[model samples]
Target chain A: MPTIWVYAEIDNGKLDPSSLELATKARELGDVEAVVLGPGATEAAARLGEYGAEIVYASDDQVYADYVAQPHVHALTELIGENAPDMILFAMNYDSRDIAGRLSARLGSTLMSNVLEIESVERAKTAIIGGTIIVDVALEGAPKILLARAKSFVAEPLEGGEATVVPVETTVPEEAKRAKRVERHEEAATGPKLEDAPVVLSGGRGLQGPDNFKHLEDLASAIGNTAVGATRAVVDAGWVPYSYQIGQTGKTVKPSVYIAFGVSGATQHIVGMKGAKRIIAINKDEEAPIFQISDLGVVGDALKIIPQLIEEVKSRKG
Target chain B: MNIAVCVKHIPDPNVPPQMDGKYLKREGIQGVLDPGDEFGVEAGLLLKEAHGGEVTLVSMGPAAAQEAIRRGLSMGADKGVLVTDDTLKGADALVTARVLAAAIKKAGQFDLVVAGVESTDGYTGTMPGSLAELLDLPQVTFAKTIEVTDGTVKVNRQTAEGYHVVECSLPALLTVTAGVNEPRYASFKGIMAAKKKPVETWSVADLGLAGEDVAIKQDVAGQTPAEERKAGEVITDDGSAAKRIADFLQEAKVI
Candidate 1:
């Protein structure tokens, strides 16, 4: 069987959900092994095993404590050289992107980012030009790197055997440690993370202003496991933080259900969420491009329909 | 502190890019500076103002890429450098990073290099890290706020849960996210002043590199338009749109 190596990330002594999601996809391609870095990563191996990681290769050293991407690059590159995995997968995050790029340079290999699907064991697909075009990419080398978009694959836990933990030893280059961590300011997440949210309610310039975003928030609250997002229009207008922007230039999300409110389905915005399993678009303009891809299109003013939808959802639960 | 900001010239995303057969058609599309690079340029300028140094703009593209560098120069950068080569077309991110690293090395000593989190066109968000690794410098990315002092750089890097305060020494590389600051519009006087600024143009040979050194390794076997979703049921309500949506949600087993 083809062996796939997943770059697992550890957060607060637990395996990151996105990393586990990568494992979930990696196992489908072949024998799934996880390469985890930093302190406390070994502790998360059991959880990684539950999510389809057959073997956990871990590196926990002082040089990795600072969260620099280079150290992991040094460690993982050595591991990949020792055991030549057919494919390597990573979550599409800051550290993973950095590491993949550097590793690709080191190995003289190809790194494909924002990947949506595994077309086969060798080929994958990604959206280009803000989702207006989808391109199938083929990597020509062993140990090809694939950075999957956030939430592209669901993290499913299976009842299976524990992963055999293997410790890998490597030296961190002095230059990699040049970057240090002084402080960590945690922005208390108000609700479910957008990537993990099962349902996403997004707004755009069609909402008129920032204040209208509250309607989507209320609707999100009504539907548990929901998060709020905005199009680049609202983000550029300074109405919402860039963290909440979902578009070609923003975060690519693949929630189970995506509800676009007052969003005009610009290809820029569509590229981000078009991977959603079910898309529901609400807009007054009947010809909005968003409706073209939506599973359910509602032609009406969102300001009027949102409140009613929230009430209906709440009443149904009651 | 001497700073280098990497910028990209891309076809205006506001205008839909056309496709000639399977490739992106760039002949008629207007090229502009990638929007994300504005924040990088702004951050470099701010660092220069506070620390008292020069901010040099570096870019790799065809002749028209000079337009992007000039825009940065107009935004208060001291000078600009453009790396243009006929053989550099279709170069991937790793190759591009190598070229940029070579250019930065030739530009002389720099305390810091800044870049946008990702280019709107390529959207890989990997160049800065690749460049950092190639240059053997510390790299920090997704900075929401950046402060430089005492030969050190500290940034509040954004995260899924919140943010982290990452610190690195001078001679580091940082990739800033949007919302870090509001980039200023170039004043008329600044625009006129930019015309006289010296912009050094270089070829691949000047960087002491052959075409194969920065050649793209991946092959695009083929590109087809993404599959379109089928026409779905549209409900235009006079007054019952909400009820229909509620029912539809229930029928779809989503509510």
Candidate 2:
């Protein structure tokens, strides 16, 4: 019987949510274990056992310390070679994505990136196909690579217990600089995470400059537990980061309720969030593409809509 | 600075339309090089302009996609290559990357490969990462800023929260973010020059990639019309607008 292996992501020593979700999903596959890469290898392995990993493979070598594409890819490839697990699951994070490709090639197995939804996995040979997912993929031969969209799957804490910890040192050549720590910035309030949030509030070029998003931020805060997203146009306008974009180019978030204010809803933008449960659009253009998919469309200026929407939320909650 | 930018032609999403049965009713809808791919081409141009090298545009789709190649040429690419074969339709990112990889290895002139984060339709956002894997090259996807000099390169990758800048070596792969560069329109002179540019077409046989190697495992299944939405009654009065706003939130389950 083949066991499921999860390539866990960790910062400092805490496990990333994606790795947790992967372990939870892997539960269905059979015995689920984790492969953690970080400084606190032993402690991280124990944490992984609590989360769901029956086994923890950790490292603290120079190559694995700082985040660099080459070293990480090399480490994952070597791990796969030794274990030869049937399936490998990675959270669709930057590092996971960059490494999976290398591992897939080195193993000659199939690689499916950014899988939004996973339907089933009974017989190892059952075929999987399309359903709001990027594509239906089946890993035919040996070890398989699956990069699950982290946000689509919900995360829950697992039973706490220290697991068997296995330590290893990753090797790097003399020429490598060992990717140095440069700069890191965090969003003011990402809210509950756009994917997990019940409500997603996104803005577009109608919101104007990058600073104008202050109103959006307030609106998101007023909505209390909602996440903030952005249209491709706004992201392209440099008003927001591409990660915040709610279009084809950004995160394809499907919240319970998606609200678009001052968004023109380009097709590319709509593709990202069209899966939301309920969509509401507020734009001056009655003919905007956002209106095409919005369940409730309000044609008006977004600047005005934001203030009014924010006030109404406060009033109702009061 | 020698760069390779992969381009794909997509249906104009701005136009209201869907696949009616098998063929596109394109009755009124227009088509254009995908906006994301335009960014890829533009990013390649910027790299070439800065590092003083050539930008090559590679298109793998139907012959109609030649327009995408011409557009890339118009964008200042030194050359163009179109890999056309009907069987290449609906190619999953994995197979598409393999096909491209074979062609890339054959050409053997690229130092950097750039592609849109995702196509307007497939929308997987995995090509750059996948291609880099096939070629065993280091990759930086969703790049906000990429500066290369000599053999060293620095890139800013966008994450959910803020931004992180990374420095790496050359011969890397990058899937650019949309805001990284504004795509310039093709000039009239460029368009004229594009007509004379050479675009190499490679088939599955020529590329040494079998249909099974590159064809999508699944068919589109089908495309349903986007649910129709109405612009509802206008708020005739200011007070009425406020009322609708309140009722809207209640109905939308926001409150």
User: Which model scores highest in DockQ?
Assistant: 1
Off by over 4 Å in 2: A12-14, A121-139, A157-162, A173-181, A187-199, A221-227, A241-243, A247-257, A266-278, A287-295, A314-318, B16-30, B208-239, B248-255
Instruction: Candidate 2: give the clashing pairs.
Output: none
Against the true chain A, what TM-score does chain A of candidate 1 give? 0.83
Question: How much is A104 displaced in model 2, in angstroms?
Answer: 2.9
Off by over 4 Å in 1: A28-30, A50-52, A119-122, A154-162, A190-193, A205-211, A223-225, A231-253, A264-271, A283-289, A297-301, A311-318, B232-241
Question: Which prediction has the highest TM-score against the true structure?
Answer: 1
Separate clash counts for every candidate: 1, 0
Model 2 DockQ (Cα-based): 0.36
Between which residue pairs do clashes occur in model 1? B111-B171
Q: What is the per-residue lDDT of model 2 for residues A180-279, given as tens digits with 9 covering 90 to 100?
A: 4366666555558776788888888788788878888898888777888888778767777656867544577878788787888665676568678778
lDDT of 1 by residue, B209-249 (tens): 88567777665667767676766888886777777777766
